[model samples]
Target: MQIKRNTALMVGVLLILAVAAWAVTRPAKPRLAAPTAIPVRVVSVAQQDVPRFISGIGSVLSLHSVVIRPQIDGILTQLLVKEGQSVKAGDLLATIDDRSIRASLDQARAQLGESQAQLQVALVNLKRYKALSIDDGVSKQTYDQQQALVNQLKATAQGNQAAIDAAQVQLSYTQIRSPVSGRVGIRNVDEGNFLRMSDTQGLFTVTQLDPIAVEFSLPQQMLPTLQGLIAAPTRATVDAYLGADTDNQTGDLLGEGHLSLIDNQISSTTGTLRAKAEFSNPAHKLWPGQLVTIKVQTALDKNALVVPPTVVQRGLDSHFVYRVSADKVEVVPVQVAYQNSDINIIKGVQAGDVLVSDGQSRLKAGAQVEVLKEPPQVIHTANAQVQP
Candidate 1:
């Protein structure tokens, strides 16, 4: 029994030593620290004149589009204008074979001459018969008959003259002319081809490109604002842009114009109203049927709070911005009044408030931020006079 008790005490002591060693030598549990600040670029909110614009996709249209067709039926003898040639009004386009018309005119003139000669003879005979009847040299009925012959010959000559005039008018139709000043499109018929007045496919087309127009549609809700602009003494300004960016935020400017017209009726099916603007396309950049982006300036705000569009973030319920305050960023909800690719006119943010433009993906509410760079400050100086 004494030996057993000694062995039990030894085992107990070894167990206690193992437990104490484990308690002293085990690795320490790591404690986590707060997240580090994110580096970001920021810009201060600003107050400036912000113009409100309505945007839409539009198509360029020519001021005048006409198909040049022959007015008479004949073989084309002359092709005066080439394809894609710029022409002015009354320019010769083509000429048809006018030989038939000329021949007919000559025939009518010959008939008129013959009739006139016969009428002269009848008048001479009638004068002789009147003198003879006064002296009772021939019957009164015979003199009256001679007078009727003169009248009949006179009527025939007038009819022949009318025919000559008609032939001359028809001859003029053989000379084809451009009714409008424009550029000629593709030619439908070559020289030596026969053309008819009833031909559906015309000789070519003439499209007026300069001072072009753009047609676009806007939502019906904008009708009132558009009406107000139309009622103003001065026309509203419009801008057309080329290809849009990947995000469709903006595009390269193509040209500027003024509002020209608005459709009388709105499209019930599409819930949109059609509008048109005219641009002085001297450079001929805008082509007919080409698609473009259009912006119509409907109104202007003199003093509006604005910020860079990149600083605004879209959330599930509202748009927000990470406003920087003393090295900390807080979530700020903003109401966007208007937005273009460059700037956003917003509410709920004051001027001089700094907002994060980049590195917002790494931020949350109450997160810390490190400003990478400050925006450049502008200094205005008064005009100075130079001394001689």
Candidate 2:
């Protein structure tokens, strides 16, 4: 019994030592630390009126572009206007060889005078024949013959007058004039060159610079929207840029214009509708045949809940935003009503709500957040005031 007690005590001691060793060496139940807030950039939602725009590729076109061609085939005797000269309608651009034309005109005038004198003499004789025929003093055949001579002379005079008018018209063509008010392009045929009516190329081109038109094409789906713009009470505004940036936030703005017209039919192959906008290009910034990007304002959203584009995140099913509650952010699903490069109009958040603008990649639902910087002052419509 003593031996068994000693063995039992030894076994109990060994068990106690093992327990003590484990108590000393094993890790204390890990002390829990509060979750750290994720660092993020945040911005407050703003309420403002925002304009919605649609972009398209466009080409600048002159409203009035004319090719200065010779109406009559003749020698290009004189070039009065220099290249790149601004001219008005009816301004003399050049002169043709008018020697032949003048000669023909002078001959026609002389013929007209001679015919008038002959007609005058025939009329006097007809009067005398009528008086003698009234008493049967002259034969009926003689009186008839005199009257016929008078009629022949009258016809000759009328023919001569028409010839004179034709000559005058031919003479006026010798002085080539600008048909439109515009700037003259580079000349093809110089002075002293023989020009023809059938010449494929003309002397030069005159392109109207001010109040130019821009031709653009949009998808056929936007036809209804464009029609609304055209029928709007106020003219819809448009902007032209250098590159085809659809957001229209980049590149230099070339000119501003108003929506002019939409094409009668859409292009069957491209499935796009052609549209035009007219811009007041007094500075000549918009040139003919230059390719540009166009933005047309389709509508304006009043009191829109605006936020930075980065604030909205695109998820697999729908878009979402991180709405900060206290130190934590909740993923709030949002619908982007209208969006541009700078701002996005969202539907789920209020004007005073704070949103995560950056550092979204490290975020999730109910994630703790640390705002990196204070948001900018929210500029309200009536007065610029910070949102609480």
Candidate 3:
């Protein structure tokens, strides 16, 4: 009986061991099967001859503006211009009281009269002496003395005349005029305020609005391309807009402008070169210190393989994109030429290749995808890129 019981116990222990072995070795419950299709939006990559563009933020500035101030000092008497009023060059903007200056001018005129009378008397005496000396009628010493007196009196009269002219000029300076045709800023000094020549405080400011400058900066890497663009016999042109929201609201298309200036040195910290373009602000839409966006072509890549910007994807170290293939979504490595909001100019992608555009966040290598029936509109190309 004992032997039979021990045999049964041994069999039960062997059975338990076999079951544990099977549990450990069994394949993970066959992973829940993948869905039959993945919903996605796709775009057909095309080599739409895209003009290369470099983009940067810039500030609008008036072509010529300066703070108007008095060159000569006096009590501020009249402010001739109102704030925000348009003024033309040489227009009187303000005036200082010139009562004292007028008096000084009169005094100089009196001095000039006195010197002239003295000169006339000396001339008469010199003439008389010259007549007397002609036939040894007067001593040589007397004639020489009379001639010297005449010359001295003449010099005194000229000096007095110069003083009078200087006084008149000072009186004219009491009326300050606009140096440029532009809108006038707020007036700092009112009537009865004392002004001084040494004071640098501005009485008002004038800024030209019809034509303006848009200042921007580009990376140093673009220098070679910019040089190439410049070397082309036909200079490129660029357009500047005022309103950031809509191109239409910005005003009559500010006329096209050309590359005006480039900085000699690159910024140490940012590695960028400053640049400027002059655009006609016909409607006065561009203003001083207004922030703006600019699109400029630093270089153009001929026959570049381009794709929609939305198709480009950020992977680990390199930028990759999803190329729709027969079997599944295939990850493609691409070299980017440039990127804008709607499209990207790239080097690796080719024409007619279907690229995954909308659904990429959850995509992985070899992930199956389905293209939505709706297609996106393409941005048509026209107008050669101008250097502005």
Total clashing residue pairs per candidate? 0, 0, 4
On TM-score, the stronger of 2 and 3 is 2
Q: Clashing pairs in model 2?
A: none
Ranking by lDDT: 2, 1, 3
What local distance difference test score does each model get? 0.86, 0.87, 0.76
Error of 3 at 329 (Å): 8.3
Q: Can you tell me which runs of candidate 3 are displaced by over 4 Å?
A: 1-40, 226-256, 300-305, 309-341, 346-350, 353-371, 376-388
Off by over 4 Å in 1: 1-19, 25-40, 107-162, 245-252, 313-320, 329-333, 340-342, 359-368, 374-388
Clashes of 1: 0
lDDT of 1 by residue, 199-303 (tens): 989999999988899999999998998899899998999888898542243577788999989999999899999999999988888899999988787877777
Q: After superposition, how far is residue 358 of candidate 2 from its true place, in Å?
A: 3.1
C-alpha root-mean-square deviation, candidate 3 = 6.5
Q: Considering summed lDDT, which 10 consecutive residues are worst modelled in model 1?
A: 379-388
Name model 2 segments beyond 4 Å from true: 1-28, 314-318, 360-367, 374-388
lDDT of 2 by residue, 140-183 (tens): 99999998998898899999999999999999999988888999
TM-score of candidate 3 against the unseen true structure: 0.73
